[model samples]
Target: MALEDVPRLGCGRSIDEVWAGIDQPPTGHEEHCQYCQTARTRLQRLQEATVALRESDLHDPELKPRPGLTRAIMDVARAEVRRGNRLLVRTTDHGTIEISEQALDSLIRIAATAIPGIHSRRCRIDIRTLPNSPHETTSTARAPRLVINFRVAAAAGIDIPKTVDALRQKIRTAIPAGIGIDAGTINITVEDLYDV
Candidate 1:
């Protein structure tokens, strides 16, 4: 890999590859390359920190993370991948929240505006598309999963988690049950807490 590729690796590179260069030291052109040197230094520091943390006897729940932590981490990481260059997502809210990554912003704009709720203003929702693998042969399978992110009125004395959970259930029930098409994954992100 080119020297420039080293720093661009971010956290994606394998630890072995990183350590190999750091331990053995790259010769010739690589020795003079600043990018590789910086990457090596960063990797070494990260390794040291990881080792030190592992050896520490601290038992903080935050550091250890609760169960399903990996799943949560993946969710956040996947959102970044889905967001890409798109900044706003809109869908036509027609008493039902039908959201998907494809034409997401436009669809959210339509859906949210149709719903009646003054406090529901300024709701931003992002839908991520999840494609079905080729190995799975389902004739009725439609598009990929859609992850929805939105903000709604929270101060309506409503149970936020229950409401969100109900909304998700409604989406799952209505989409395939009514339309007979698998509606991709729906992820809802509540951006702002509103007082209703």
Candidate 2:
């Protein structure tokens, strides 16, 4: 289901709303409602994880993420409160491992910025799930194929085709290496140019 289509808790509050008010004092309904309390607790954990991840990334000198990357990471973290559109990474007898779409977007942005002369603008990920073989077991279920639509700005005087090819190759390799998920079709658009 789409993020917006995801159902609200019994208290009628979306997780997004809860996250927005995470720092505020709890309302009477929130204090008494079990669903609201649970959502708040879980969201707080997610908030902590986001902060930790940001700190680690910032301290890693080799990463050198683009300017405003921290803000972008927080924005994605906030949007992830809706918790929809997760891609399956693997399946086992124990359970399935999934990664959020926003996390993948952040990974893509970071990967794109690693290529010199390329700056990521925006990206969207779509997934197409192929039918499983009739004999295949649940533990070995196939993951949905990922199709990425990425927009970027290139440094002036850069060879557009060559640099973009490098960008594509970077994304293709990075996704699998970073998250253990294979990237499928990648459509890149050089939407703007920036001075180097």
Candidate 3:
């Protein structure tokens, strides 16, 4: 067989089948095929390394979660949220500031979740502005018009329409001024009615 073909025999067989004899009873194929011989030698070395690792792990002391691990993870996540690209909320004659998409979504979730009897699952945000709609000639784009979709479940025994209306009002108050959203634009899907 060519030098390249030695590796092809192990392709279809599992490593367990090829290395069955190592640290165990001998298999008969080791004497016949040069490919199997070469593969067997390499597999023996890997098996030795793995056994050493397992023995070391067994001898080591038990590992426990670090103190304040949850707080450290949350701090990292908050920093990542702040570092995201902030959308252009609007531009003024003096200067401008921005907010990240992640932060915006978080606020929307907070607004929807705050309503009594409502449990919000997910939310999506969309922004669009017409091309050549006179904002092009302007220095900055228009305050981006947005559409928000909310998925939620209402608690049993609560009036559905009232709950939805309350949600709409809360969201309206939650959103900043000059942003174009309304009861019509706030799409709420009632997924289920849950007790307690």
Candidate 4:
């Protein structure tokens, strides 16, 4: 069948079949023949770039998030997403990306950190504080509610629960607003009730 007559892969043929069909020597039909060559070259380049990107190292700080790196990674991710793959967009610059689960986590943490009253270094999100903890007694009107644990070296006599509540509010506000992600849930557990 003429290249034009052949069913397009996307428009459904297996990759092997497509490759085999294209590899067959072009017939004398100039129009379809040229189209086949162009399609082959384009697909080859895309495959080459995909392999190159897969082997790329994005772990080193110097290379981890270089400008435009995220966009490059996102380009591939978007392609996959369009192909029915569910993937997260970690970073993007003009459209490319470098998908890294660690990077996404860091982004989320940074978003949480940006909240006012949240000490970036000292505070953490999703920590589990037991119901009977020291701070639970302040509001004993009902079942002890969980807290978003923010470990801080706070001064003695400071109300840990109160401080955590304020931090939680800041995190909730900053996360969606600053990073555009839903602030899922915050359960602050104060591990280091420091003397600060």
Model 1 weakest 10-residue run by lDDT: 87-96
lDDT against the true structure, each candidate: 0.53, 0.87, 0.70, 0.50
Q: Please state every model's RMSD to the true fold in angstroms.
A: 20.7, 20.7, 9.7, 20.4
Error of 2 at 137 (Å): 3.2
Candidate 2 per-residue lDDT over residues 53-118, each given as its tens digit: 999998988788688999999999888676767877666677878888888999999998789999
Question: What TM-score, computed on C-alpha atoms, does each candidate reach?
Answer: 0.29, 0.55, 0.53, 0.30
Q: Please identify model 3 stretches exceeding 4 Å from their true place.
A: 1-64, 94-96, 132-141, 177-184
Q: Whole-model lDDT, candidate 3?
A: 0.70
Best to worst by TM-score, what's the order? Answer: 2, 3, 4, 1
| Model 3 Cα RMSD, 1 decimal | 9.7
Worst 10 residues of 2 by lDDT: 135-144
Clashes by residue pair, model 3: none
| Selected candidate, larger lDDT, 1 vs 4 | 1
* Model 3: number of backbone collisions: 0
